[model samples]
Target: MLLRLPTSVSEAQQCLSEGAIPVGGATLQWAVWQRDGFPEQAMSLREVPEANVLSAEALGAAVPLHRVDDRVPEVLRRAAGGIGTGAVRRSATVGGNIVGSTLRCLLPAAVVLDARAVVLDVEGPFETDLAELTAKRPLLLSLRWRTPQASGYRKLAEAPGGPPPLVVATAVHAPEGARPRLRIAVRDGYEVLAESVECDTGVASVLDALAGTAIGALPAEAREVVREQVTELLARTAA
Candidate 1:
């Protein structure tokens, strides 16, 4: 078992280039460590200043979920705060949420945020638009984006209240006219099923649009309930 804790981004990048798996806040890594003990090569990012920084210069990927400022962009803050529980929030980093699983909410939120995710390899920094990473899994170094006017997010789980199957995230910025520009991303369980940029003038319109995109993936009985909840959620946020 071996652990390399890097104090700076370059040190972390150097370790990663040497094939160490990146680990920040170990929430997702614990299960793997339990089964595999220590990985053949591992890097712990807890002490890395780059991994904990959150600001206009750094993206959410390096930020700890609980430490994000609530003022930067409301949607991102809400998304980060929703990762798991209090304990998980303390340990989980945004990069983990981005690449962790098929059931994560951050990527969809990233779409609405129009975020850019970066990866620093030994070759230097390689960047990709956030939307590009939704389908393909990419290890991230930092995530950056411009803050919008207002944004909202909703996660709906099955009866037990465990991992959610459906997540609806929206971002709004005032356009040239009366209606605000809307960007939305919808995830049903394992994959992001759909995303749209449109002007949804009313709640019914938004419900219809999301339902049309995600209805087939959800159970028949649950569709109406989803619609109801999504409607209320959008309306509440809009107001």
Candidate 2:
């Protein structure tokens, strides 16, 4: 049997307690179904949650739960691109992105912004970093993060439309009085995070330096052209 619950985690838990698997988003399940034709009892969060997953407020804002077919911003859509195809985006939940750490995941952005997620369980509401929690436990409810300065997200696709094989860098241009921050996530690959510098100077120089710095940190010797392109983009943006 399938069960649908309100967007609240308490409601979700109620279903889980009643022997439901608690499918926040159907991305994973749908993927299995599409590829392998697996059939199983499934619940949809699309309708019960009111078809919303995110909302912005004044630090006390509450977001409604959502289901499939709801539209979001281009940036958000891109951010949720970890799920890949169009069908997945429609049915996927932000909570699933938080849990799976899929391509173009939004949690990284939330992490960059120092956001917190309010997770409600049978106990009560608990707060934590959306990204950090993904590293520890699967998120039980929602995620929240503070706004960043200037934010930039770039993905290095393997082929033309393939998943990123290298790095998907998400940067938060530090607040007016703060230092710039960057998160370079390397997929199916590894990057050195031991030492790095934060620049608040001109954008061109930073991008140039980023390429060389990143290249220096890498182990593979495939090519050095990617660095050059990144440096060039930084230059153009700075210009």
Give the alpha carbon lDDT tens digit for every residue of 1-239 in model 2. 44455555456556544545445456565666678764434433444342244544112112211331124322233455644676656655666655543443554345444556665444555776644565665334554444443344444555775544553333344557666654333333422121123644654555556557544456443224334433443454355
Please, what is the TM-score per model? 0.77, 0.62
Q: Rate the local accuracy (lDDT) of all candidates.
A: 0.68, 0.45
- The lowest-lDDT stretch of 10 consecutive residues in candidate 1 is 192-201
Clashes of 1: 1
Could you tell me the TM-score of candidate 2? 0.62
Clashing pairs in 1: 59-143
Global lDDT for candidate 1?
0.68
Score candidate 1 by TM-score against the native. Answer: 0.77
Candidate 2 steric clashes: 8
